[model samples]
Target: MPSTLHETLIEMFRERPALAAEVLTGPFGVSVPTFDQALASSSDLSAVMSTEYRADAVITFLSQGEPVHAVIVEVQLGPIEKKRRSWPAYVANLHSRLGCPVQLLIVCPGASIARQCAEPIVVSEPGLSLTALVLGPDAVPVVTDSVTARRNPELTILSALAHARTKRHRAPVLEAFLAGLDIFDQEHAELYADVVLAALPKAARAHLEVLMTTTPHRYQSDFARRYFAQGEARGEARAVLAVLEARGIDISEEARERIADCADIDQLDVWIRRAATVTKADELFA
Candidate 1:
């Protein structure tokens, strides 16, 4: 549904406006806070610093109380527009409107382009870094919070990307990938399960027939995929505990039992927290 990169980025940002700041300052690279403290901003989202209207969907980021400008983001979905005419004015007006220094970022779906300096220094001023984002199937979707990928449309996007990576073939069509995964072969089965997990809507997958046929073998296969790949199985109990332990969580036998029985992911998350820290050797879980 989100055909263009600009549309996709904008939609994702709106899903987590706070992420705009995180992505801006992250490895996507402009200068950003770590993913852990991604949304702990100092700026008042309700505050309107400058009325310098220049373009549509070109957004800016401001640190909460910090004077330094956080970031400048432009969602370019299509060919350059006449709005390029007003970019200089937009930059200058933004500086005068907001006290923080601004950095320029051009976020595109497929490719990015940047200009070192703006000719109308009065408007754009100086020291604007141009950058781009070309997110494609081969690209891994930025992962920060679980919900970032857990949500619906985004879940679909992540599944597409992961499947694209595993299959030596060209990026598979979304529907085609689903059909391929429906077969449930042995070798690629675990990998396909990841795609299914990634593809399942936060609301839940309605078409889980191939995945949820529930025969002894199919159930075992599904359970194996969840347990091994996600460290949710008997084979993974200790390992899952280690990851949770890093965050100071501890696991118990009862917790392990609870997780093993949980086919629903939401419930599994609860047990994952408990076992995350209580286990010993990574190899045991490994």
Candidate 2:
């Protein structure tokens, strides 16, 4: 099982597939084919051979329903000799599956580990080798501007993870990270906050906690209002479902998913009111 830090890092990419492309083309200066959308594809790279292979995450770039490029994301915190071998296999299998060009992007928190991961992987086949594109602490830019942070919150969070310990940058980085968190729902906001805190040094973490608690204007901003409204919608959705279930209304999978996926506060309010007296679960939609 992957460690908590590993999983949290991967979730950032999984939630925002475009972040992969942004990280690639933005800071890394790698050219990526233009695509209409980037979607999370199956990470399973298992071949017909005896051993099963899987990657951490696979992002596929699609243009008008055609695959343009695929990226395999691997988060490495320490050196593992086996990865040198498996990394090549991941690229080969995913390329064959997608029938598109594949690239391996590795995320390392430490510079030394990044160097180790960046080493070229030599394959047995003549003239065949793989060089992974590595993103380490040095590659991630320190983001202090709220405008830039909000433009790409995931990247901002990644920036905090990388540079939050630097005394000169910690304050601005934490401030920007908090500003970026406004866009996420309550759960993600809190989770990402925790992850950032964990990554910070003890003194930096203490400083952030003070900011988190004492910053009154942060909670008074429009972002806070929106965040609270999202919480209200979630609560209302659950209450609507609860009322229906208590009344013996059978909600179809479609109905359940609709309620769970809804983010509009007004729509949830309407559903909550309808759920009280509706004879059937579907009547809430009506």
Give the Cα RMSD of candidate 2: 8.1
Candidate closest to the true structure, highest TM-score: 2
Residue-pair clashes per candidate: 12, 0
lDDT of 2 by residue, 151-191 (tens): 98988988887888888898888888878888787778767
Q: Using lDDT as the measure, which candidate wins?
A: 2
Please give the lDDT score at residue 13 for candidate 2: 91
Sliding window of 10 residues with minimal summed lDDT for model 2:
215-224
Candidate 1 local lDDT, 92-202, one digit each (tens)? 555665665545444443322223122223323376432233333333343323233333334334444333333332122233334333343444444444545554444
* Per-candidate local distance difference test: 0.42, 0.85
Candidate 1, which ten residues in sequence have the lowest lDDT sum? 38-47
